[model samples]
Target chain A: MSVLLDPFAYSFMVRGFWVATLIGVTCGLLSCFVILKGWSLLGDALSHAVVPGVVVSHLMAWPLVVGAFISGMLAAVGIGGLRKLSGLKGDTSIGIMFTAFFAVGMLLISAFPSMLSLTTILFGNLLGIAPHDALQLLVISLFCIGVIALRWKDLLLFTFDEQQTIGQGLSVRGLQLLMLALIALVAVAALQAVGAILVMAMLITPGATAFLLTRRFPAMLLYAALLGGGLAFGGVYLSYFLDVSAGGVVVLLQFIVFFPILLCSPRGMGWLCSARGGVR
Target chain B: MRTPSLRGLALTANNGSIAVDIQHLSVGYSNGVIALDDVSAQLPSGAICAVLGANGGGKSTLCKALMGIQRPHRGSVRLFGGAVNRMLKRNTIAYVPQSDDIDWDFPVSVQDVVMMGRQGQMNWLRIPSRDDKRRVAQSLERVGMQAVARRQIGELSGGQKKRVFIARALAQHARLMLLDEPFTGVDMTTENDLLDILREERNAGTTIMVVTHNLSSVPDYSDQVMMLNRRVIACGPTAHTFTATHLGNTFGGVVNELLKVTGAVAGEGNVAMSRSQLPEYPQ
Candidate 1:
C-alpha cells in the first residue's frame, strides 16, 4: 500500500493514471466497432503491425507513437486491399500481413540489438514516459474519441452494410478509410500505456464482454468504456502490490472480469451454448 | 448533366417518371467476368419491378449498379431525374442485401439495426431526434417487426430477420428501394406481408425493385419485370414477356440441362415441364 502510494505522490503517477484512463475509454469505444464487425483479428493485426514502426523508431531514437501509427495504417491498407483484390477472408489477409510485418520488425531489432531492450518494447515503463509523451497521449485520445463520437452512426451503418450505406449515397470507401485511420490512431496511442501485446486485450475484451451483457449500442459502449477504465486502473494497482508486469495484470483482470459475463450474460456464450445444447 | 427528363408524357401506362434510368451500363468483375453489358432500362416510379433470372445472372449486379454499390464501366445511372451525387445517396436510395450475408452472432438488436437507416439523415455527433425514433417505430410496424424491436437481430428467424431489414429500409423513407433476395428464407405469409409493404410504398410514390427467384408470384404481383442473364434478355409487362421462349432464350442452354438433371433427381416428372423450368418472368 505504501509503495503504491509512493508512485501516485509523484507527477509521473498522475500522468500514468490519466494515460490509462484515456486508453481505457478510447480503446473501449474502438473495440466495440471491431468486435461487432467480427474484426477482433484486426485489433490484433493493428497492434502487431506497429512493430516495424516501433522497432525502427526505437532503433533510431525517434518518436515511438509516430512510427507505430504509420506502420498500423500501412498494415490496415495492405490487409484491406489484399482482401478486396484476392477475395480471401479478412483474418487470413490480416494474418499474412501482420506476420510478415512483425517478422520484418523483429529482423530489424536483431540487426540493431543494442539500441533497445525487451522491457521497453513488450511492456512500457511508467518512469520512462516523458511529460511530453503523456500530453501527446491526452491530445490523441481526445481527438480519436471526438472522431468516433462524430461518425458513430455512419460507422455503425458502414460496419453493418457497406452496400446499404453506399446506396444511401454515403461514401463507403471514404468511411472505411477514415475508420482504418482512427483504428491506427488508437493502436499508436495505446503503445506507450499498455505496449503492443496487451493493447489488443484492452481494445477487444471490454467490447466483447459488453456485447455479451447488453443489446443497446450506446449502453454497450458505456459498459465497455467502464470495464476498460476499471481494468486498466485496477491492473496498475494490482501490479504495484504484486510487483509483476502491469499490462499483463491489467489484461488478465479484464479476462477475469469478462469470464463471468460470458457465462452469466443472457446473450453470452454460456447462454448460447446452453440453448444450443437443449436444441440438440 | 447525365439525366433525361420525360415527365408528363402519356407514356403507355408507365404510371410514373423514371426512378432508375440507366443507359448503356456495363459491369464486370476485375477478373473480366461480365455481369451486365450495355444494359439499358427505366424503372418507373410507383412500380414493383421484379428482376428475374437463374443463378449467377445479373439480377443482383444490376441492383448494385442502380444502388451505387458498384459503378458501371460505361454509361450512367440517374435516380429521380437527377444525377446521383454522394450526399443525396443516403436519403434517396435504400438497399436490403441477402440475409445470409450477415453474421448471425453479431451483437446488435432489431431496433439498433433499424436505427442505422437514420444515420444517413442525422449528423454524426447528434443523437437521434424524436422524429427518428417515431420513424423507426413506424417502419417496424410496417414490416410487422415492432414485436421484436428489442430482440437481438441474430436471434430472429430467417423470415423475421428479413422483415427487420425491410423495416430498416422503410425507416429511411427512400425514394427508391432495392432489395436483393428478400424473399429467400421467408415463409409465405412473411413474403405476402413484405410484398404488401412494398406495394404500399409504391402506392405512396416510392419505386420498388426486387430481385427474386420465387417465379410463381412474379407475374401476378409485379407491375413490370426485367429478365436478366448477364444482360438485359428482356424487359416488359409481367404478363407478356414471361413466355417460355423468352425464358429459354434468357436462361440459355445451361439452365435447361440443370432442369433435366434436377427432374431426374427429384423424380417429379419425365418431361421436366419446360414451363416449370422457365420460371415465369415478371412484367
Candidate 2:
C-alpha cells in the first residue's frame, strides 16, 4: 500500500494527476457528442491538425496552445471546405486534411531542429506541465463543460436532427461551429497531458465505455467522467511504479477497461451471458 | 364534414389564414439539375395539402424551399403572410423529415426527442420548465408512445419511430406543419393513427403539407392535392384533382399503366377504390 501511494508524495505527480483528471473528465463528456455525431475521426483529425499550429507557434514565439487551436479550427474548416468544394464525404475529407497537416508538421520539425522536439510534441510532457499550463487546461475544460451544461438540449437536438433544429428556429450552423470550436479547445488543452495522437483515445474511449454501461445520456456523461478520472488516476499510479510513459499507460488502460465492457455490452454478448449467468 | 371541437376553435382563432404563399419558386442543385421549376401554390389554414409526385419530381425540393432550408433561385415563399425567415423566427413551422435522415443511433430517449420540440417555445439558456415537461408528456401520450418514453430511440420499431417524430411536431405547437413522407414504411395501424392526428391538427386550424407518394389515401386524408413533375402539374381540391389525366401528367403514364395493372378505373371514387385495391403504387 505504501508503494502504491508513494507517487502522490511528489508535487509533480500531484499536478500530473490533476491535469490528467481534467482532460479525462472534459474529453469524456465531449466524446459522447463526438461518438453520436459520427465524428470519431474528427477528434483524430483535429488533434493531428494541431501539430502544424504548434510548429508555427514555436517559430513565432507565440503560445503553443493558441497556435494549436487556430490550426485545429483551420483543419476543421479545411475539411468542411473540401466537403463543399470537392464533393468528398466527411470521413474522406478528414483523412485528407489530417494527413496533410501532419506531413507539414513533420516537415517543419525536420527543417527547424532546434525549435521544438518532435517526440515532446507528438507525445505529451505531463510531469513537465508548468503551473500556467495547468491553469490553461483548467480554463479550457471549464469552458467546454459550461457550454455543454448550459446548452444541453440544443446540442442534443442538433446532433439528432440538424434540419429539424433549424426548422424550430434554432441556430444549427452556429451550434455546429460552437461544437467544433469546443473540440479544438479541448484538443489544445489535452496537448500537454496525452499529446495529439493518444488524445483521440481520451476523447472517445471513456464516453464509449460509459455508453455500454448506461442508457440515459446524462448518466452516461457522469459515468464517463468518473470512469475517465478513475482510469487516469490508476494509470498515473501504475506508470510511476512500472517506470513507463504516463500518456501511453493512460490510453492503454482505457482500452483495457473498454474491450471487456464491449464484449459484455447489453446488446452484444451480455444477452447470452445473462441467460447463462456467466458474467455480470 | 367533422365538427370543429372546442380545442380546434381556440387553435384557429385566426381563421381564413393563408399559411403558405409561394410564387414562381425555382430551386436548383449544385449539379445544375432544376429540382423545382417555377412552381407556385397557396394553402390556407386548416387545409391539408398532399404533395404527390414520382421520385425525383421536386416533391422534397418544394418542401425544403418552403421551410427555407434551401434557397429559392427565383421567387418567394411566404409563411403566415410574412417572409419565411420572419415566420421561422416566430416559431411558426414544425417539420418531420424522413426517418432516413435521422441519426437513430443517437443516445436520446423517446421523451427527450419529443422535448426537443419545446426548444422553439423556450428561450435559450433557460432550462425546461414545468409547462415544457407537461407539454412533452402530453405529446408523447398523444402519440400513444408513453409506454416507451424511457426507451432509447434506436429501440423503437419503424412505425414507432414515425409516431415519435409526429409527436415531436405535435409538441412544437406551430401553426404550420411540414412532413416529408411520414407514411413511408409505417404499419397500417400507425398510418391510421397518424392520419387521425393530422385530422385533429387540421380541425384545430393548423396548416399541413405532407409530401408522399401514397396517392391511394390522398382524397381520404388530405383536403387538397398538389401534383408535381418538376413543377406544379395540378393543384386544387382532391375532388377535382385526383383525375386520370392529372396523375398521368404527374407520373408520366406509369400511373395509368399501374391503374390498368391493378384493374381500378381511374375516375370518381378512384381515391377510395385505389386505397383498397392498388398495391403497385407501394407507398
Candidate 1, residues B129-149: lDDT per residue as tens digits? 999999999999888788888
lDDT of each: 0.76, 0.83
Output the worst ten-in-a-row residue range by lDDT, candidate 1 chain B.
B1-10
The best candidate by lDDT is 2
Cα error, candidate 1, residue B69 (Å)? 2.5
Give the best candidate by TM-score.
Answer: 2
Q: Tell me the tens digit of each residue's lDDT in model 1 across A117-212.
A: 556666766446788878878888899889888787788777877777776567888988887777778887776777777778888999989988
Q: What is the interface RMSD of candidate 1, in Å?
A: 3.0
Model 2: lDDT equals 0.83
**Model 2 chain A weakest lDDT span, ten residues long:** A271-280
The positional error of residue B56 in candidate 2, measured at the CA in angstroms, is 1.3
Best model number under DockQ: 1
lDDT of 2 by residue, B31-145 (tens): 7899999999877678788899999999888878877789999999999789987788788888998999987767788988888888867867747789989988999999999
Q: Give the lDDT of residue A108 in candidate 1.
A: 82
How high is the lDDT of residue B17 in model 1? 69
